[model samples]
Target: MATTAITRFAHEEIKPKIGSRILNSKEELLAGDLGPQIRELLEQSGVLVFPKIDFNDDEQIAFTKTLGTFAPEMQDGTNHKIHKITLDVKENPQSAEYLKGSLYWHIDGTMNDTPILASLLSCKVKATWGGNTGFCNTYAAYDALSDEQKAEYEKLRVIHSVWATVFYYEPEPSLAKIQGMQRIGENELPLVWNHKSGRKSLVLGCTAHRVLDVTPMRSAEILVGLREWATQEEFSYSHDWSVGDLVIWDNTGTMHRAEAYDPTCNRMMHRTKLQGEEPFE
Candidate 1:
């Protein structure tokens, strides 16, 4: 929305409500002052796409540091900070099982005290059929709700757990597996997150288990209805991946998921995350 020299490089309003494509070169994106501008744009546009930016692990890490605190890859023992996202057990044996949970829409790190600020993902290998990533703008979704709906949802609190997402992928798991997922714990989050900027966004995603103090059937009905409303085509974007494409989205204000693909398709993405500054109050 704001115009400047960078406006020439910023091709925004890509969709009705969500994405902006940055046409700048790597040099411009790495410039000292561009970080704040990019962050500002990210707030206005929930998703930003860099076509064929092709940033390696170190370059991606450097870019992430410019935006906010860099969240390193802690699972694998590799020295590199970027985490490879793939379904291939050979590449990410230990973590691939957890990635299956990503098939359902979720806000990253909901189990943590503070959720992640943003996520930067670069496409490495493209899948043959499906692997498109979809993003829904919660801010826009919240703004579209009726006054009665807003007032009702505003007072609700949600119980979120990693198990909520995992169950979507595995409806019936062994008792041991269920217990393992529960160990990740749960947190009570406001159904609507009122940001410091005074903008509010709905926090409905697969990680959301249920509405606290509500009947089970009522909670399911509300959650299912909200998820459908928030993810309608008008408020969402589905990105078809191309090799070397890079995408970054505001994790706090958006919910995202990968479109189902064959496990053998060989799709891989390198990801880096920016640490969050606010809690889900």
Candidate 2:
């Protein structure tokens, strides 16, 4: 099969002078056909950018559902809607702190058993400077590793928890909210997740605390070393946002983070999550 497909969609309707109209018109953008080319690119690139989308929370929520299912089913029998990661200076002040860490380099839903298949974030209010998102291809990162390292890593496992971060914000997070955080529903993560495609990526990041099969000290050293390696300048890209930008990354094989920005300035965003069905084995 052919590998490495790349497709990008952009619109001039999302510039400073004429962006507000698009956010109000989310259904059209959400319903547009993304075509097979974009799907293949998503598989190959681990990230996709829909720049200058004229989409709002309702519309962005609509678009994310088209990508995948709502992630992390709650225990209550009611499915949490796909729009789980909403951000606002007005509504969720306490959460805004933990979100500041979102500006760091990491992946989504590491705490879940299957994890989130993907996460889509839409910018409603853009900061004037330094609020771009950076994405890295974990599949590509693994492919670039030395053979010996890959061989050694194939046997390792690590512990990941949303509690580590959630408790950092709301010590007693809501049961449903905690369930979303704890999908994949495990106490740990394998250091190497072999995708159905057979590509493997390192599970090293801030949420990945330590190796399960190794000593804590050794695990820390290994995870940190590998994280530093994969995130090297060569394997990543940074995306600057204009108002109404929406970006999605595969949580299974990519790590993402927001760049620091003027938080005091308006920086509103609405995030939608995709529930994972199959586990990567």
Candidate 3:
């Protein structure tokens, strides 16, 4: 049970012995410093894409529970209080319009009280070519900026909501529909977050609708610019999924999105999120 950031073994050795044997034999994954190292790595890098893991739903859920409370995907149910995505999302396009937003680069569940902390995604089906999941290291992006840029961002706070942007171009949103969004605004989160490791990161993305205490038009210009600046290729990594691969990212420090895939072919992936405590203080 090697630990303390041991390099993953060669895939030849790993890819072959990746069944219940490895799952049962591996202590580091179960109860060792590998857990903490993975935790630290996620906070440091904002993204962790291990090569592959032969994990079942029960095993995946079990592993995720080790980190913190699990946030199940929101399903569309009449009485469901929290957002729990229904099975029909991927099955039917008309019902999955909300998920279409995921095709664009954005943070997840930022409109809620606990802005989803971490996301654990398991790839069950692979697209022929496209469908890569892209992750932007906001921590790295913030650090690479000039001190002047950092200073400028520190003074900003953005408003977030679920539906305003979802229906942005719509001229006349129905009154009931607008109210149904359950839009909660006026959240004063910092644009620059200083992590415990002395690293700083940007926290801007699509859900961030407006700047607090700033003019609406200028705020849009600034936010659009910042998003463009932070997501440059050098600070980003794209994960092309193989069956059984699991990727995790710190939602507090990174933004992510799914690339366009041919929905005609079977494409199924399950995502579990960790609840965010504070938007990096």
Candidate 4:
């Protein structure tokens, strides 16, 4: 095992609001002292980009464990910890349709009682056209709101479901089609998540369906307004990935989406998730 002192590594802010780029080598990332620094930085900066880190499945899994507990159940059936992120039917026939939901803005595991803590994605093959991952800092968005707006939002709750996210890709999806897809059932989550760190983040995303105690139209209005507010350019970063680039984002405080790409572009990414320690309150 390698050990590198934290003082030796440097990181630069990628954007004023959301992202930080680690100015260190892949070997330094695997070092013992780096994970705590990375986790602390991740909490402050919503996303961290390790340009061209090129971590393999085993190396990615090892790094993930350093930050927090590895989510073993997040893996696909191949007995490997990495889940291949691609649109190719042959590579992921059973789950390709569900993966299309990634094209929309969402926090991972919204329907789960406890959503994922964080996600690590390493780009293996870059698409010819577009496959950039976009991240928005919901924490910043929430904090920027007027006190009155915050008060109103904090009183609200929203329902999340797999069907809501799937419908983002397929508008007017048939009931049968939605039932056929993987349904995690619906969960009612607070519109504003007050984390253990004493920070609050807006939990609005595509998976979010409607706000409680409001008419359907009013709920739609609130959800849409919050989504727009959270995803404004200043509070978000779009990462144009190169092969070997590895990125991790604080899933609890951010929403992410993949840019549109041709289905045949052969873009591939390997992903590993960190299990959540806190539930949405």
TM-score for each candidate, following the candidate numbering: 0.94, 0.75, 0.77, 0.94
lDDT of 4: 0.88
Per-residue alpha-carbon lDDT of model 2 for 132-211, expressed as tens digits? 87777677778887889888888877777654556543667788777775663445667888877766776766677668
lDDT of 1 by residue, 27-49 (tens): 77776457887898888889999
- lDDT, residue 167, candidate 1: 74
RMSD in Å for model 4: 2.5
Q: Give the Cα error of residue 203 in candidate 3, in Å.
A: 1.4
Candidate 2 regions exceeding 4 Å error are: 1-32, 70-89, 163-186
Would you give me the overall lDDT of model 1? Answer: 0.88
**What is the alpha-carbon RMSD of candidate 1 to the true structure?**
3.4
CA lDDT for candidate 2: 0.65
**lDDT values for all models:** 0.88, 0.65, 0.65, 0.88
The collision pairs in model 3 are 73-85, 74-83, 74-84, 74-85, 75-84, 75-85, 75-86
Residue-by-residue lDDT tens digits, candidate 3, 118-222: 987877777766988887877777777788877887888777666655664354778876676654443556677666556677877766778888788989888
lDDT, candidate 3, residue 237? 72
Cα-based lDDT at residue 177, candidate 3: 63
